[model samples]
Target chain A: MIHTEQLTKVYPGTDFAAVDCLDLEVGTGEIFGLLGPNGAGKTTTAGMLTTRVIPTSGRALVGGVDVAAQPALAKQVSGIVSQQNTLDRQLNVWENLYFHGRLFGMGATTSRRIADELLEQFQLEKWAQASVYALSGGMAQRLMVARAIFHRPAVLFLDEPTAGLDPQSRLALWEVLGQLNRDGQTIMLTTHYMEEADRLCHRVAIMDHGKILALDTPAALKRGIGADTIVTVRAAADPEQLAAVLARDVAGVERARVADGAVQLDVSGGQRLVQQIVLAAERAGADILDLSITEPTLETVFITLTGRELRD
Target chain B: MAASDVTGDVTTRAVPARIELQLRPVLTASYSALGALLLRDLVVLWKDKWVFVLRTVIQPFLLCFVFLYVFPKIGQGVGGGGGRRGESSFATVLVPGVVGISIMFQGVQSIALNMAQEFGFTREIEDRVQAPCPIWLVAMAKVLSGAAQGALSAVLVLPIAAVVHAAGVHAHLDLRWWIILTLVPLACIAMAGLGLVLGTSFEPRNIGLMFGFIILPITFLGGTYYGWTTLSPVRIGGFHWLQVLVLINPLMYVNEGMRAAFTSSPHMHLYVIYPVMAAFATTFLAIGLRNFRRRVLA
Candidate 1:
């Protein structure tokens, strides 16, 4: 539904380009996540793809129309939910949705009916007549989502869809997004939340400093790291002794390090190695205060690839 | 799994369908979009109905009552020829000028100032720009809304200016039917165009600078206190340069046209009035539309 080739945007006053040589493709009926930290060019990329920002160079096509050459046509097929609230604070919920529908050339009666259905579906029926200013943060975010979908565009771009919401609100919004994808809307969203990307996105691209570091399914990304488990052993004595023991005994131990009085190890067969390490440590008369076993997570994969935390 | 498969299906179906739809005339669709945008602005404004009404009527009311009625009675004096002569009364001259200035201020304050805020922190205009229409249409919607507010200000100012006075301060509203019908709407459009340009040119942070640098000068030099022709004597040599300088001001024509409609005052020739006002509307609109597009894209 969306494609970009070497898409770059350089602001006038800035020395560096905000979006640098971005090559991306979002398939039809798939929810694609663009994961990045702040100033990582996520919003800039979304703006260029949605035709809100003109590209300095390169090309973008949305729903089969060149965004630079045919912006109005591109706009017709795509909806954008910006990071900031764009809802008219003065207008009621129903009016906001109805107005958006009409802007996309729907008839008044048709738009009104669709707005009513969307308000109910988004669980905003009671607040339909209420002013936007009166709505809670979550309600306003849901209204923004409903407003974006009012035109029934083929593609939707949500920038930080749940940035400031409480945990419960974020979960509710995720459910709404899942429902939208199920009903056949191609969704592209930008977020910094690894858990959100892992749980909701069918595919995610990890980005930093205006470049994509990696792109794959959540499960595929974890598997691609090739580490089955992460084992940590906290020692009452010296951690180096426990680390040396694992380094010698476990054949598939990829790496061993000691930090914060804990012996950390990455191994392929973690459960079997953990048993052998416990027996070996007991024979050496070294006390193990605690032990932890974890499956490889998206955070670990991100840290391995970028050498920096995703939340940073 | 291959990229070719995705591009092939989209090219075979989606491109052709979109092209077929594009071949049809876009005028009706464009108008529908414009109507929707205007309705959206109106609905948003409707929630602040009391504030909207107050904003529309308050300034004109206070100006008319204070300057026309109260000042003249309290001997603060507006400095017209001291007579009950039909054309020389202070109230007679001030009424139409007040109405004209009210329209201009309404356009600037409601449309331009409001647009500055929208383009500022909230960026509420992003929603409007996402509509399936050309970017110029979004700017046009703002101008139209401003013109509507200007018309309301005109209606609200006239009656208050006409009746709030002591004896012998007559406001003989000639109400030239054709001039009233044609010129008022034109005057509203001209003011709105001016507002659009100023709104787009100034950032929200510099709005106070706009009032200080642009609006105050326009209000004073726009022939609000006196007719444009009357400024000929306040000129160098026989050139009437002061009169000519104010000719570039759009509000001058609006006020002069209003005087021709509302009272028995001399005004600039209609030949000069119509074309210059049209020129102002066209120039302001073109520049405003360009600036609005630039700001939105930026």
Candidate 2:
């Protein structure tokens, strides 16, 4: 649904492109994530696609319409939730959404109907008449998203949709996004939240310094590290002894170490290996205080690929 | 993710039908979008009606009250200070100037000050530019809305300016219907266009300088205190340099236009007022829209 061909934007008087020669594609109905650290040009890429920032060079197409050549047409099929809150503070929640619909040439009645549905969907019905300045951060963010999609754009670009939110509000937004994607809306979200990308995006592009470093499904990206699972064991009696026992007895235990009163193991097929490690700990007379078998996360993939932390 | 066919059918059936039924016939989609943008500003202004009225009326009221009423009552040097005739002529000149300045201030307050805030760190303009119209149209909406506010300020200021005076210093308002109907709106729009130019040019941090260097000078030289004809006396070897110089100030024409519309004072000729105001409006709008687009993209 969204395509770019070496889409580059070098701001005036700058030596480097904000977005380099970047070729990317997002298929219809996919929830794609652009994962990166700050100053990684994620927002710039989204801005180009949304027609808010003109590309210094190259081209972007939204729903097959060239953005620079026919910006109004591209705008018709694209809605952007900028990293900053851009909701009209002078307007109330309902007015914000309704006006967005009207701007897209929707009839007043249709706008009202759609705005009502959006308010209900985002659970903003109670605050529909409330001024934007009166809303909490979470409500304001939700209202921004509602205004974006009020016109039912074909693709929705959410730039850091969950930044600075409490855990509960972030999770609430994730559910809303999931439902929108399920409704067959193509979504491209840029975020530094590793867990958010892992949980929500069907595919993610790890970007840094105006370039894509890695792109794949979260599971596949994590598996690319060649470690299927991580087994961390907190042993009450002796972590060193538990680590020794697991290394010797647990099959597929590739490596083991003890730190912070815990024995961590890199193992293949940890579901099965964890059971053996647990049994071995019991036989070794070391109490297993806590144990977990976790697949490597997107953070692991990001660090391995970029040699820098997601937030760095 | 696949949407159900039932949902798809409903969307297809309802969206276009509602568009046809509710949107005004013969209105292009662009016009409706522009109208909606202007309407949003009006709604916001309406919500803050008391604040708006206070801001609009206080300055004009004070100008009229001080110069027309208080100055004469206190035996101050104003209104030529000769007799009833002198006081009345000064009232005629000051009334239009007060109305003119009010319109100018309205344009600046409604558009420029608001633009500064929107373009600041808040970035509210991003949401506005996202409206599915050309970027220029977005700036045009600001001008149109600002013009409407300017026109309203003229209406609010005029009666207060006309009546709030010392007993001897009464404005002789001609109430020329043709000039009032035509000139006032054009003058409002012209000042609004000027507001757009200034708003987009100055940084928010330097807005104080806009008033210090630009607004103060424009008001003082904009024929608010005296008619353009009065400038002929303040000359360099009969050059009428002050009169010639004030012509470049857009508000001078607006004030002249106001005088033509509101009083029978021997102001600048109508031949100059109408065409010159038109040219100023066009020039300000052209420059303002260009600057607006640049600032928005920047």
Candidate 3:
């Protein structure tokens, strides 16, 4: 549904390109996540794809139309929910959606009908007659989504759809996105939250410094590290002694490091490794106060590849 | 036989559906989209109907009453044409001037001030620009709405202004029907174009500076209290430099056009008024469009 080849955008008076040579494709009816830290060019890429910002070089196509050559066509196929809330604060919730539909050439009656349905679907029917200024942050974000999809565009581009929302609100928004994808709308979203990407996206791309570091499904990206579990053991004595013993005893230990008075190891079979590592620690006259075996998460994958935490 | 008949019906229905989709009438759809944007703005104004109406009528009404009626009643004369034979009374002379200034200020306040806020912290303009039309059309909608408001202000202010104080002011209002019909819209358009340029040029942070540096000067020197021709005697030895200075002000033509339409006062010649106003409109529109495009892209 969307494709880009070496897409780049460099703002005037800036040295480095905001979006540098990004090669991406989002298939029809799939939720693709562009995961990156703040200022990592995800929003710039989405802006160029939506034709809100002209690309400095490269090509993009949305629904078989070249975006640079035929921006209106691309706009017709894609709806954008920018990072900033673009809801009309002066207008009521229903009026905002109705005006969006009208901009896409729907008649007044049809626009109101579609707006009403979307409002109901987003659970915003109670706020239909309420001005946007009266809405809470989560309600306003949901209204922004409703306004974007009121035209029924084939592809939806959401730039940080869940930023600043509480956990419940983020999960509710993810459910809405999942339902939209199941109903055959292609979705492209950018997010800094690792769990959002893991739970929502069918395919995820990790980007930093205007570059895509990696791309794959959440499970596949995690599995690419080859370690299924992380074993962390708290030590009463020096952690270096326990780390040395674990390094000598555990065969499947891929990496061992001491942090916060705990010997943490990435291993293949965490259950067996935990049993053996605890025995080794007790024999070394070190008390194993606590032990935890965790499944490898996106955070570990990101740290292994980039050598930094996603938030950092 | 029954299955074949159902399949034939479905195929026949699909063929026309494909044809209808193919012939979907592109230009009309685009025009309708533009119209929808225009109507959307108008509807928003309508929803705030009382506020808009009060905003349009109140300021001009107060200015006309205080400056034309109450001030002269308290023995403050506005013009030097009080005792001349063919000259108009102060109220007569000030009527069109008040109307013209009101329209100009209305355009600036409604269009420029509102644009500053939209392009400020709220960034409501972004949603408007996201409409399916070209970016230029979005800017045009702003100008059009401002012009509509200006026109409405002109209509609402004239009658209240005309009948406010009638005792010794024998002001003959020769409302040239043709001039009123043609020039009011032109004046509104010109003022709206100027407003557009001002709106895009001033960032919200420095809007107070814009009024101090630009709007105040334009209002005072815009031939609001006196005719442009009347300023001829205050020139340098052989040059009408004051009149020439006011030429750069778009409100000069609006006031001149009002003079020609409302009273028998000697005013700036029609030939100069028409072309100068047209030139100002074109220049402001070009600059406004360029600035709007640059800002939106940025």
Question: Highest TM-score among the candidates is held by which one?
Answer: 3
Question: CA shift at A43, candidate 3, in angstroms?
Answer: 0.2
Better DockQ candidate (1, 3):
1
State the lDDT of candidate 1 residue by residue for A1-312, as single tens digits.
Answer: 789999999999999988899999988778999987888888889999888889999999987888888787777778788878888766778888888888878888999999999999999999988888888888899999999977777788999999899999999999999988877778999999989999999999888888888899999998887778877888776778778887787667776776555776767755477678788778777777889988877776776677566777
| Model 2: how far residue A6 lies from native, Å | 2.0
- Tens-digit per-residue lDDT, A1-312, candidate 3: 789999998999999998899899887667999997888888888888887889999999877668788665566667888777778877788999988888778887999898999999999999889989888878888898888877766678999988888888888888888877766677899999999999999999998888898999999999988898888899788888788888888778887777656777778865567668878888888888899988888877877777666897
In model 2 chain B, where is the ten-residue run with the lowest total lDDT?
B17-26
- Tell me which residue pairs clash in candidate 1: none
DockQ-derived CAPRI band for the predicted complex in model 3: acceptable
If ranked by lDDT, best first, what sequence of candidates would result?
2, 1, 3
Q: How does chain B of model 3 score on TM-score?
A: 0.86
Report the TM-score of candidate 2, chain A only: 0.81
Model 1 misplacement above 4 A? A231-266, A271-293, B1-28, B44-50, B86-88, B232-248
Candidate 2: lDDT of B165? 87
Q: Ranking by DockQ, best first?
A: 1, 3, 2
Q: For model 2, name the residue pairs that clash.
A: none
CA displacement after TM-score superposition, residue A247 of candidate 3 (Å): 5.9
Per-residue lDDT of A120 in model 1: 94
The per-model DockQ list reads: 0.36, 0.31, 0.31
